[model samples]
Target: MALHSASVNSKLIFAPAGKESHGQAEQFTRGILTRSDLDQTSPIWQFHKWFAAAQRSELVAHPETCCLSTASLPSGRVSSRMVYLKELDAEGFVIYSNFGTSKKAQDLSTNPWASLTFWWEELERQIRVEGRASRLTREESQKYFDTRVRGSRIGAWSSRQSQVLKPIQGDAGDEEDDGRRVLDGWVKETEKRFEGEENIPVPDFWGGLRIIPESVEFWQGRQSRLHDRFIYEKKAPTEESVQEWTLERLSP
Candidate 1:
């Protein structure tokens, strides 16, 4: 059974009684977004501009973090998770993950379409990217893999991501029993396997997935709930190597 909003609201309580509006929503005054503000040439150039601003802002932390959303085919069950944007080029945006067992990989196998959402609340801005994802070649993936720390490289080899973990059987009250130990043991084994080795090989199951965007949208918040939105959509299917984009404004 679902609870009504009134019932849910009645039971909610916070610190400092009578201070209902202490941290309430405020009118957005950061800046206005307009059609003229967007880059005429390419959305990637525009994204670079906003992203550089985010990187420069003192209030923004981990600007590369974004929500990656994927939907499984047939049933179309959607799932989303936070992932770091590792690399971006003229082609697309790249993120690394376990391609063998992770849920996103499973979804991508069945449905190549995916979307990424980046929200910077402090800046009152958001960006949405919808695209088709494909795995990067082993050589390309290896290049990025080589840049990761030793622990992370080992972790890539250790973890069978999205797989259910089982703790050793024990009495219900046994505090020592833990499912996480299974992963820790795998890590220890991987560590020993590469001991004294200067370079660890990138696991075949882990690599980068690049999202080649078909459309990208930029949003900026405004007062009175009226906001600004601009979207860049692929012009059309073409055999040409270089893709072109058509920009338009969306009603708030």
Candidate 2:
């Protein structure tokens, strides 16, 4: 274990962290995991294995970060962005975003279906999740919102995220610097606006979305350009029983 520290609002926060690389790339052999090795009941459990491995591997940074892709219905316009996976359970995957600002949010509003991808390049593994996205309850959103860093919480309130930004006028020479100056000004203003205010409420337009998976596929790299692939697909719910899922191996 190793010790690490971070400063937030002039307060020091310390924690332990460590992940060491084992050997040279050339020395590491290709990974192999067939369907027999996969969890047959719940892909969520299978995800736990890969996720834990990624977290332990030195090459994996931000293992919880995944690509969330949403498509606008009929038009088929698709957009994707990296979002931190905040929660994962028997329910689904959870992430927070500005509900009204981002195109991805808008897309999900129109079409609930979404696709998520988690790629651990160093481990030669990728997991794809296809599911329907739904807004989390107000209480759930608030609970998680309270855990975010102060600046992030303020950001959810300030600077309309994903909105078209106005270009600065006049000769600032360096537009990038001028843009940052304006943003910093907004941050300061927001901080003051919330001064002495405890428990900054979650923004009405910002909250969490949970993806309810219907199908999930896991891929592992192997030799000779062949790969190991397995999928767990949710079966249709019967009137007498709840939702059930089945696992099957897929052609590489």
Candidate 3:
């Protein structure tokens, strides 16, 4: 079911926690979410708190990963992919990737809107973000690129992400092996070309995108299929410096 449907049925629907002979499900009573514990002044702070908690726990290996969804403007059919959330601020969530390369990036080009989901199964918590995707400044992109390892930085050049690869030419042991050799050649060449330079050239198409959230929702699983759902929606843009936001609990 959609999170914000006009039907006014905000209750969450989930199959019981298990696949049983009688289709019975396990109840999730692991955690409690209260408005008193969540800060209304800033949803970002609340998000940081939850994210920090997840990071500190041994249960999470990579808490920064989030699923990002985007659609082609004309078609409206959406596609989702896992991306690492590299940065977060009052502005919103940030992720870096090759622009105009992957299908998701193409979708974002046509339709700037995006939705992000961060689910920590161990914590039974999820955060959903709806926003517009906009490119980061060149300086911002370069700054992050500087922090990447040598091989990954070179990979940005060697890989034309989501692009179809050409069939390897000439006689070879096997097709897959030939393709691997071809890729390795590119990587080797890239490494050699940048060996002398202190700063390798960041791919012109590689950069970051910030999801400027229109709304952010936090969910916590509860017992008897009741989940805590709270959403913070931006009040709207104005001439003022600080944007206002409204927080409310959805019936779940």
Candidate 4:
């Protein structure tokens, strides 16, 4: 089911056969972003500003979500999934997950570079981050882990992140093709293991991964498709020099 059309005045007016055109096309005149609007010192600071606006806007939901992408080695196959942004610090952005069996972990094992994309459509803004991913210290991970609800913590320990789930043979009728029982059984077992325990330890295979950005780009949509873009690139530091970032305007 492919609905296609050419853009007129930068509005994507979709035309599908035997149907009326979809919702009214909108021109992106929400805001005009400029270089001076960004923080001169750090991309992190600028990101915080935009992030705060997104959080406050009624039009945005789940503003902390972003697309995380990784590429497998040798084959160079790329994979992406939506993940919640768990924390941010002076160094970079952080998210937590099973770092053992997940495809992302496997990719990171071979290639450390990864990318994150945040698209706030209602605000007509996007941000791209490219960085090297490294595991957060166990102690640091525990700090975030302790904040999770009990069930999520149990889930982190119960299931292998990316493994295929196959229902046990002869355990149920043909209707159970999805193998959800296997997951339910694991969850029940995990629950019993920690029946009355007040505290749960973070699994060794699960924790936080922080992406130290080499480059961060901010984009804002405009009318006529002439978008605004700026990028902050990290610079290498010498023995006597501290780290620094250079900001440059990008052609949209």
Candidate 5:
């Protein structure tokens, strides 16, 4: 086997030996199972094994974090990037980014629909989720943000993300002086904003987006091009009741 690099949003492409076309190789590579191989099981148990394996590997490798993609209104092109997955639960996957951030925040405003994919090569598995996202409560965001290290909290306050960085040349002392000034300004502003509370409040623009998964599909690779796949679909409630899901197998 031979591997090569192709610049597609900073992602790598691996090809087998003697493969002539990258596109053909990519299509072949993505030929995993469809939604027809799963057996009837509880939603949690249907893909328990694969999910556990993904979690274990993610803990160590943190494969590509989480990618957030959104389509702008009318006919604008879509944009995506790698963001950290903060938490995952029965509710859905949770991720935090500044509300002032461009792609995510804007998309969430117009369209709350999103998708998440997790790929684990060691396990030959992939999990994809599609869902609607909503903002987490202030209490939830504060609880998580407060647990971060002091330096991280300070950094969050000291820097403006997604903004251009101006070049400034100076000696070590001058740099130190600049940093101190910025830090001091942040400290004073924060103190005044929070009324001198020792526990810093979570920034209003920083919070979490909880994706309520409407569908989750799990795929596993097998030899001879025969693969296995299962998809779980969340059932809508007719009345004011809890949501339920139905599992279905898809054709490979």
Candidate 6:
């Protein structure tokens, strides 16, 4: 007997044994959605308060950014990620990343405009920001890095982010070593290799970026999909006059 198969139009549905099926799967996810159902307040300050409270629990949250940042790599492709919001004040949202990192840094060099988004799953809240990025001084970066635990500081040195990793011969058991052990081992090894060095220096590649907001929008999700939005916009600065910010309510 001979093996046989049937085809529908030009596509084949069956294949020989051991052949694997190839296709893409649909993805579905849900969140409390905003719709045209609830009463929206004219004053946005009310929603802003709620949004700020939801973010207060964690400085580093996903779907959050000091602002939206887009960068074009050397390969001419754009990449984006949620960078940690390190500080926020009257000035704007503050964040830090390596100057050598491929995303926002390179783009900031040419174009400074950026945007950020914050979404709270539990409370059904979201905040969007548009801004310009400015590099923080080395002093500021060093100050923040110094405040970090010693292990974090060492990890900063060990991680060459956005770079490939190479497999090497070493005791795999070291993978389970604690931060203190790794730091101590690195220090001892450095001292031995460098003829008794006393301290390890901070790496030059690490630093921070500060995003100055030009506009900020806060969103609140309500029952039946009606959502609330409030936006703050700043006027451009002039030589004789300082920039000013105004708040407005937006239709959901």
What is the full ranking by TM-score, best candidate first? 1, 4, 3, 2, 5, 6
Per-model TM-score, in order, reads 0.89, 0.82, 0.86, 0.88, 0.68, 0.62
Which digits, one per residue and each the tens of the lDDT, describe model 1 over residues 1-252? Answer: 666556744635444324553454677889899888899878888989999999999778988999999999899999999999999898888999999999998899899999999999889999999999999999999999999998899999999999998887667887875698889889999999999986888888999999999999999999977999999998875687667899998988
Which is superior by TM-score, 1 or 5?
1
Q: Which pairs clash in model 6?
A: 35-225, 67-115, 67-116, 68-115, 68-116, 96-208
lDDT of 3 by residue, 1-252 (tens): 666655655435545435543456666677989888888777788889999999999798999999999999798898989999999988889999988578987897788999999999889899999989899988899999999988899998888788766656656664454356667778999888888776976677998899998889999999877899999898866687678789999988
lDDT of 3 at 158: 84
Model 6 Cα lDDT, one tens digit per residue, 6-65: 434555654433344655332123233332322242213433454466658564355344
- List where candidate 2 sits over 4 angstroms from the true fold: 1-29, 170-182, 238-240
Clash count in backbone of candidate 6 = 6
Computed on alpha carbons, the lDDT of every model, listed in order, comes to: 0.89, 0.84, 0.86, 0.90, 0.67, 0.60
Instruction: Please identify which of the two predictions, 3 or 4, would achieve the higher lDDT against the true structure.
Output: 4
TM-score of predicted structure 2: 0.82
Candidate 5: regions farther than 4 A off: 1-51, 55-60, 168-198, 238-240
Q: Which stretches in model 1 have alpha-carbon errors above 4 Å?
A: 1-24, 170-174, 237-241
Q: What residue pairs clash in candidate 3, if any at all?
A: 16-25, 17-26
Q: Which ten residues in a row have the lowest lDDT in candidate 6?
A: 35-44
Could you tell me the lDDT of residue 38 within candidate 5?
53
